[model samples]
Target: MSDGYSLTVELTRGGDSNNRDKMRATVEADTVDELREKVDALRDEMQEWADDFRNIQPEYRRELPDDQSQLGEVQA
Candidate 1:
């Protein structure tokens, strides 16, 4: 029998505080190694998409908070 793994990924774009995207998926594999490989592949795919978006739309790229105090608050 295969084991099931649950993965949740959240990607945020733009300086807007509320703009965010979330994805959840389940992956099944017969071995731990296979599961890890599958999870890593999915993570890499999402990262690639994020990089492309950031490159294509510089205006929508995420900005770091200016001050340390701002870090305490949630940002998109």
Candidate 2:
């Protein structure tokens, strides 16, 4: 059996050529430890973004009810 580990993602925004981006990285090592190190780094990066959501300003964030009463305004 073979263990495969690699990731590639393409991103495009606003139909702008300048906004096109691609990330190509891989873990080709046959050892599990090396793969864990790579995966841990990815986890850390993703966590940083997760941590950022709290720092975003209220206006830039999705709106939520100010109280139990306001929650009904968005109900279907």
| Top-lDDT structure, candidate number | 1
TM-scores of the candidates in the order shown: 0.45, 0.35
Query: After superposition on all CA atoms, how large is the RMSD of candidate 2?
Result: 13.6
Give the top-scoring candidate (TM-score): 1
lDDT of 2 by residue, 1-76 (tens): 2776554422222355543333334444456777687767876765565456435543555567566556556657
Estimate the Cα RMSD of every predicted model relative to the unseen true structure.
12.3, 13.6
Instruction: Tell me the tens digit of each residue's lDDT in model 1 across 18-55.
Output: 54444455556667788889888888887887777656
Query: Which pairs of residues collide in candidate 2?
Result: none
Q: How many residue pairs clash in each candidate?
A: 0, 0
What is the model-wide C-alpha lDDT for candidate 2? 0.53
lDDT of 1 at 43: 80
